[model samples]
Target: MKIAELLRSAALVTAVAMIPATTATFAQVDGRAGPEFAKLFATYQRIKASYVEPVEDEKLIRGAIDGMLAALDPHSAYLDGSDLQRLETMIDGNYSGLGLSVVMEDGAVKVISPFRGSPADEVGIKAGDYITHLDGELIYGGDLDEAVQRMRGIAGTSIRLTIFRPGRDEPFDVSVTRGVIELEPVTFEVQAGNIGVITVNEFSRDVGQDVFRAWQGIQREAAGRVNGLVLDLRSNPGGSLDEAVELSDLFLSDGAIVSQRGRARGESLLYEAESVYRGEIADDIPMIVLIDAGSASASEIVAGALQDHRRAVVMGERSFGKGSVQSLLPLGRDAALKLTTARYYTPSGKSVQEGGIKPDIAVPQLSDPDWEKRRKYQLRESDLRNKLINEAGLKDEELVEDNLADPRFKLTADELKEQGVEDFQLHYALETLRRTTPSAVALRR
Candidate 1:
């Protein structure tokens, strides 16, 4: 099926595509006896007959399936029942809970990044914090799904979270009241000097259209012509791949946007500009895209495409580096497999697997007080166990760090705060645009 159709069928599955029945073909299994298969059958038989206590066949089968998927990579998983329902709710773009993207790290639920303006972010729960307890009960080493379920509740309901933040002396407790998370995927504001600032929270359905509408709104709100644009993609965990392509198409009039390659013939394909949207919306305006370690999958797609075409100057830290694509293949009516099916490449044939897109201007969030401490512990796709390696053989050491001091950003966090700069990265981008001419900004490329 087309990527757009796959996304429409299951819109909630983030950074993944759904494999249609025709493309779900698999390699033929050898009929000859294999030692591995024999061993597996023997173990199953032994467990059924000789175990100390009786175990249900369903439990054993599910355990076997989970074990197989877990050994492959981090993002692959089996979804059924509540898991399937949750995925649907998330994609539908409305749910009642603390909006946070979390992952299982060392059997502990670690916060990847809290959605901006969500209950978790409002409570000051930053990324890399380990959630140790829910309602004063120990949750360490427990099932991550269970902990996540406990955190979800009706709107106005409260839950006490015990957090173990790195660089802290001890764990702390905070109570957050749940609210209906209506993800406004695209929000825009006309910044100072008629600069448009558009923030893409997550790549859900109709994001491309939303962004186009945002540009129109900015034009209406601006005093005159929009000078420049800032596309803020910080702390955004990716969603629909089709939406990513559509967003990228909005800025590019020609050239390949991205390509996906997999072992299956049907999975290898190319996405090009102008395929979804026509000519650029803000073609003449100098654009800047803000990204950080939390940016993944679809975010990387847009950043890489814009940077490759010199359509936008990508700023902020490197992205989360999730280049691999997951294909959701249904096992039955109620269950499915989220399997890693392909690795995506940018227009220049660069795979952002373990090494994500590097920004043209590497800017840091100096307004954050714990910037230094947090930078040292920031998580990326390279940190995940069994992650796919970049085809270019990029090493972890090659991951660029913005350690050099810039004269424009010399002020410390406290100094910036004193100067009324709450977000140094965004402030820097705005100042860069306001101070420099469009030709000067283009010269940086």
Candidate 2:
């Protein structure tokens, strides 16, 4: 199948264009893998004739498709029915649900991250927590799609979740009332020292435009005295590739942003600045992009681009290291294949597959009480089974870096709270900008 323009991370989904099937397709496949096809057909026949229980054709075929995709990588999968509906919901950027990005791990529903300011986040639903039961119903070893369906309902509905958090003594129950999760992809505020904090929750549609507008709002709110900018991308699971490029272009005036290369025809492409948004929206403003273990795919794209271009100082823990690009290839009217089509690289030819975009300055989130414990259980692209290997042959030490032991960051969560610092990373970035001159913030070579 020809690759689509759509690209996303593991947590997000994409809508695809349906490609008309050609009769030559089957002939070409048959000619190439005739023996493999014969063996598959024979296995199907044997199962149909000799299996103890009579299985539906739909179940067998679906299982086969699932099995094929499962062997490739964690990001690729078959999409149909509710899966397709979920894609629509994500693209619309609004849904009535728990506002969680989840994944199936060893038949368990794992929370990738909760949308900021959502009911889940408001209720303290954290990443690395596994949902074992929904509304007192055991959902372990259940379909992820089914579990997701159970979590979603009309607004004002409540669902009780039994959470099995790592490092905790026992599974705990949390009752959360679902709400209309109108995902605000970009939320901006002017912080102290005339620093504009633009938080990108996800790389959903129009995020580039949303961020541009947010910056404008920040300038207006700051009375045209904006000193610095913070592109907070913490826990952003990633969405459209176009938006990632557009967002990167906002701070970059020229040069290649990113490029993707794959084995298939038409799979290789290059994106550059000034292609999407024309010129840098905040060209002179010193900017810092914040990331963590939750950042992946399109988040890496934006971070990688800005870091490569030296437009922004990337600060935070090492990223999730997902550099593979996934494209939604339509299988039929209701189904599609979310396949890993290409491996993308930064402008300097750095692949962030297993070794994600390394921060210019590693800043830990000291404000989180469970930061140490949660980091141990935090999942990234490298942690996922059947992940694409980094071609660069990343060393063990390179993948895992010890947090810098700065005496300044020695405050406990309670101590930070007492000082009115809720987010240590953002506080650090704002302070860093405030301390440095504009030229020092830009770090132009």
Candidate 3:
């Protein structure tokens, strides 16, 4: 539920706590090996000797571990041995799993999105599907770390998942075989009208290079210049800051694309225009970037920078507002402290925190305020905002099915299906590209 702590908390799901985080029992303090460290050690010893109720050394150890990790920022956390190994595989960019990214939401594990070409996608695991139960046990009370671990295994093994998809009540079971998930960072399609569509799933280490090459390929297919470009970034939980900067540079000729500010060190790094692209498309390009709540971190940087530079028009709802940076600090032996180090700024000097970057144009979800009354009437996420249906009777919170439209994606369903991309967000983006010309206005994708 508290996503900020997800990075580190994933490892300690099964570690029973001696003292609950509440109850005034202990202070969440981090003392640097001086008197404070001595105090913690001293108190820990006292707890073993006396404490009203009986306590165990293991309990004291857990508290000390929690405090130590807590001081190092929220992201850096202790992972159980097996959980740690699983994540390492994900980071290495190859995993034999169901191929879906999930989140613990509303007492249920929901499928946030499926990786391109993963077995989950092949088996039809869609975004917004709620996993009420995995196998036969209720997953609501289970640890998310365990849920993740259970869903992954060696290639060729079958795992049964019971999913509750949005717009459907009865949970359905799907038998999926795991495979090596190689996330293809780029997917392209030449639209019927000569429009070229490109969807960047996430800004991994090689994404920028893949994107640049794809751009060239599109240009070559269109011969000299492409009619328009659709850059779809919906559900792109960000990675690699370097890729964000590199992708921004591809569009910018010369300007301060982004800046990072932190304690003690302000403006330690300034990214600006080193050189203009000598390529033919350098002078002018019209693009539109489609984003949603799932687009975060580095994705927000690219969207914010491009929008500020007048390079692209940003569309969709606000971003995930994760502008803070993390730096890993050593914590003795295979352990490290991943701490929030800095807050990044857009080229225009805006912070993507608290309130995520808002779109230039605002389009409320179709369900008017008081949508709970209308949810029964709603079908698809698009149905919540069904303009044709009079949902003026819906509640404000209930009607905001804004994910139906991510600014980064502008293609229509027809176009997406034709391109073999069922992602609606990316479809919208490709369509947006068709409507604009480079000379008209700088755009985003």
Give me the candidate number with maximum lDDT.
1
Full-model lDDT, candidate 3:
0.62
lDDT of 1 by residue, 1-445 (tens): 2334333555543466677644326446576747878987899999999999998999999999888898899889988876766676666657889987787788899998887899999999998899998999999889878888888889999999999887777899999999988878899999889999999988878888999999899999995598899999988888888889999999899999999999976889899998987787888888899999988899999999999988889999998999998988876567778899999999999998988989888898989887778788888888888877788887667886758767866788899989999999999899988876857764244
Candidate 2 C-alpha lDDT tens digits along 1-445? 1122222322353211122345764456546677887888899999999999998999989999999999999888988777766766676658899999898899999998999999999999988899999888899999998899889999998999999988777999999999999988899999887889999988877888999999999999999999888999999888877788888888888999989888766778898989987778777788899999988888999999999878889999899888888766656455667888788999999999988888999888999998877777778888888989998888767777866588777899999999999999999999999887845945453
Q: Order candidates by lDDT, high to low.
A: 1, 2, 3
TM per candidate? 0.94, 0.93, 0.71
- Model 2 residue runs over 4 Å out of place are 1-27, 30-32, 441-445
C-alpha displacement of 215 in model 3, angstroms? 1.2
Q: For model 1, where is the 10-residue window of minimal lDDT?
A: 1-10
What does candidate 3's lDDT look like per residue over 1-445, in tens digits?
A: 1223334322221101111123342353555547977888899878877789888876678678756765553343544444345444444457778888765544578775788778998887866677767777788866777898888889999888887765565679989998978767778776755676678887655667788888888877878666666666766767666667777778777788778776633324667754333332333556777776667677888888878987777776566556666553333334443445566778887766534567765432222222223234322222211111211233446434354544543544455467666544444455556766645564433
- Worst 10 contiguous positions by lDDT, candidate 3: 11-20
> CA shift at 415, candidate 2, in angstroms?
0.8
